[model samples]
Target chain A: MKQKRHETPLEAIDRMTDNSVVFVGGFGRAGVPERLVEAVCRRKLRGLTIVSNNAGSNVAGIASLLQEGCVGKIICSFPLAREAVAFRDLYDRNLVDLEVVPQGTLAERIRAGGAGLGGVLTPTGVGTDIAEGKPLIEIDGRAFLIERALRADFALIKAYKVDPLGNLIYRKAARNFNPIMAMAADWVIVEAAEEVGIGALDPEHIITPGVYVDAYCAVTRIDQMMEATP
Target chain B: MTANCGLSLDQMAWRVAQELQDSWVVNIGIGMPLLVPPHVRADRDVIFHSENGIIGMGPEIEGGDHVDPDLLSAGKRPVRLMPGGSFVHHADSFALARGGRLDAAILGAFQVAQNGDLANWKLPGARTGSIGGAMDIAVGARRVLILMSHTTREGEPKLVDRLAYPPTARGVVTKVFTELGVFAITEDGFVLEEIAPGVCADQVRAGSGAQVKTDGATLMVPPDPVSPREPVLSRA
Candidate 1:
């Protein structure tokens, strides 16, 4: 049996290059890979495209990356926040590109990318500005907008627990976008709160199977990165 | 803040809640639609769903002391779990929506067209409006209910002949509950089904940009909570 490889958060993030599309998993503050996001900010790689649910708030997450001026574009559902000055400033200055997608459509697009499907037909954005320039098809007399599958070069995610074989489980709603993102990326690196034995996690409880995960690091100082952010 | 000639925010919520049936699975949108859960009658037994992956959600936790930060609704508000509450991943949560499992969805709107088109996610010159899951819930639920003030703060009517802002969905709004009255989207146009206690038909017509038809419409009375007639029934 092949063993799962483990690396530190810094070592894992060092593999990413400039101009890569990275998917960060979280809804608001939950399920954010704080340590990995900090590593990206500290590395200061530029021209990156990030896909997430929300622009990070004042706290340390993707907000740190935006503050560092590393991201070139953000594809998300909710990009506005009261304390997200970094994103707001860049957006106002036309320094960054923003593509806002509806939450359900975003999830379906990522899931379709992983499932090897071409795209998804959804009624979520029909007759809206979101449907502009997109192909509209009628299925069973109902109108649907064709949303292309969204795949990323790498996905950085946070999980509650992981086994040596890389099977994962998440804590409550913190699971948000992590599992789908894990499947829709070329490489997936997870920051786990706990690392357990190979057979410890129940098969049914495993949200992301070992096949989708490439590597994981047991995060000890997740809060240290947030604390370091001013 | 009370409107000039219509019901209060709480009153509008109560009116919207009256549209729900017992054992219905409902997804509530952000903004004023979030107010509907509090007004649902205890006998209705509605199960609240949040697209962020919570089902059978309870009321917002008052304080942060005992709140689980991770347990939040799609609106990012802290919420408690009902007895049989469950959670799913993002994909599955949307599947429940896209697959047509939701019985009804109550949403807030910027404008509702005469033909039942909905425009709520964006304003004219805002950088970017949050779409969230409004699009999915609007189309996926069996019925889409809207909750909003009758007019904008500038006193312009939100019920319009055509939407100026981007629409969330086409012909998805089945009913609209406003401070002034309840309007149903019929083949003819926006038909006034019920008027608030103090509001008249002329005020509803004047406040709406679209034509408000009062033919066969009757005054709607608020449900009395103190009057009990039958035993409480549970779907479980």
Candidate 2:
């Protein structure tokens, strides 16, 4: 196995290119890969597609990318919030494309991608606008819409702890989209708060194993990273 | 606003809390439904599920320097977890809902059609709106209950004969709890189950855009309201 460790976020983000499909993990303000996203912003990549739960807040994270014109389209569950003005303005002006998937559907699509499934058949968003353009198959007379699997060229994730081997563990609910996204991306770059010894992280307790990780950056203080201005 | 004419914000939350049965896993929506957890009965083993992955959610952390950014509700507010609380990844968390493991989902709504159609995600004429988890929770949960004001901010009735706004889900709402009364959506239409104290059936009918059947209406006795007790700051 090659050494999957980077000394800095910029070194980890060097492989990214224009028009790449990216998965940015986080649920709201928590578990955001701040330094990695900052590096993406500085790289000034264009026509990128961002897949996440919600669009980033107005001031930082994905919001900075939208302001910098780095994104061409955003595929997310919820893109509207008081702090999500950056994406909302771009959406209203028709400058960016928006694909709104239900939260469950979004998660399942990514899961299917990682597991190499063709698609997911779910009852969510049935009898509504979400079912309008999709094929509805009835299994045992129960309606389910077909949602295609979503994969990405790169994934930016945050973890609470990591070992030398790239195994990861996340804290509390911050573990939202990181684990699944790690599996679905061609190159998974993680920013962890702490780096423990090789034998420190228990094998059974690891949420993400070393095999899925391609590169990683370790931060001393997650708070300072979160509080940084974009 | 007059004496006991309708339920206050706290009273509405208290009433919704009473509907939660023991051992039932419930997903509470963001706004008014967030208040329900504070009023839940002590004896009931209700598990509060946040779509963000918390299985046994507790109330908001009162005060301390120990606020963990990772320990947050789906609403993005700081919160605590119960003794048995556990977390999962996003996919597994939503699997609990989409797989029909959640007992009930109580949410706030913009409008509800007489046939139990929900329209909460988008408003009329809005270019874009957030769907969040409403669509998935509405269709997946065993029972979907709505908690909101009887009318809009302009005093327009929200219970309408047909929805002008886009529907979140069709024929999914099982019950609606508003300030004016409790309503059950049935085969016939909107049935007035219980009227709020100091409010009459005629008032409910007049306030509703859809026809309200009040033949079996009864007076409601809501639980007493109790605000969450936080630590009081003392000045030296």
Candidate 3:
């Protein structure tokens, strides 16, 4: 299969629409596809349901939409990037609904989302308030708390490099949730920092297969949209 | 002793970790027990195991520090790995516990029976009440120390002659620590070991559903409290 690479960042986000469920690639401040987040913000898409591990680079990645009150809801393990006045106002007004998940459970749930599991189960939150109203199934009479599946319409992920065939390699923390969420999304768009022409990327270095990625967009300045605040 | 400030969870967690001897490979379940790493004796190498993976976990993280994306605790927050700390497959980490490599495990308990049975995994609220890794850790660890709030948020005592919530590990907890004091469960009954200075023996006994006893006639003196071997909040 040939990998189609988009030359411009705007070309990459033009595929997004209103009410799209997006999964961004970023664990705290690393490997965040700032280009995608900014492009999506420019799209002015509303009622967005973003699924991610965490949000960072305030007003740049996802934080902007959250600041602009564009996103309808956020389902994540944690979200703490937007503490600015605009973002806080929306959150306090009950405009945002946040679901905090146990980290392991959240990871496993994304893995489960990719694997087609009905619901991922663990004991992480069995006795705490995290277990409230979730179905509890027993294996050998040992209790496991259930955390349901999460999916998004589009998975906007960041890759350090990508082969022309769409085989991807992630750098540092970018590898955390991008690959897993890629498999879980209906449309997977990758914003690769570097585009290695076909047959250049080593087979062993490819973390994600070409089949999982729908499109690859070469990004020159991912930092443009991702600015770390003091 | 601190006059009920709500950090009792960490206070009880501290006592539980001190119960372990030197060179103890311990696993502290998420929640209150996570605080134990900060209370361990410096000379003793009290290794902390999170089910996600990694041992010899370091301290609590300052907000917005350099958080390691690789290291995570059972709570799912980024944690710093101490020197010599290594990551393994999470299954392998559980294998270490299930294979009985841990010397002690400090876990939060919802309820403790008169005989030290633990019911830390389930509550009466709703859909789920299943044990996760506690069953494996309980049977595997040499000693099980239960860390819990002595009373509920509503001020109801949780130590009882019988368990009210779902039991995760049966008869596995060796010691129970609450805001009031430490209780050791033997075949005879739950024994009172230490009382937070101002708290009365009658109050601890009255609050607990289990019969309480001390070491013979003499008032039980507590072992020396030591600072944790490593700060539990270091960035990994």
Off by over 4 Å in 1: A1-7, A220-230, B223-236
Regarding DockQ, does 2 or 3 come out ahead? 2
Superior by lDDT: candidate 2 or candidate 3? 2
On DockQ, the candidate that comes out on top is 2
lDDT of 1 by residue, B1-236 (tens): 33686677777888888889998999975777877777777767888898888888777766545566567777777777777778888989989988889999998898999999999888887768888888888888989999988988888899999998888888988999998888999999999988888888888888889988976777777764423222222245
* C-alpha lDDT (0 to 100) for residue A208 of candidate 1: 93
Which candidate gets the maximum lDDT versus the true structure?
A: 2
Residue-level lDDT of model 1, residues A21-91, one tens digit each, is 99999887878898889888888899999999987788689889999988999999888867677889889
How close is every model to the real structure, measured as TM-score?
Answer: 0.93, 0.94, 0.63
Task: Write down the TM-score of model 1's second chain.
Answer: 0.92
lDDT of 1 at A30: 74
The CAPRI class of candidate 1 is acceptable
Error of 2 at A52 (Å): 1.0
Worst 10 contiguous positions by lDDT, candidate 2 chain B: B227-236
Model 2's alpha-carbon lDDT is 0.87
| Per-candidate DockQ vs. reference | 0.48, 0.54, 0.07
Reference-based lDDT, each prediction: 0.84, 0.87, 0.67
Error of 3 at B193 (Å): 4.8
Model 2 docking grade: medium
Candidate with the larger lDDT of 1 and 3: 1
Chain B only, TM-score of each candidate: 0.92, 0.92, 0.85
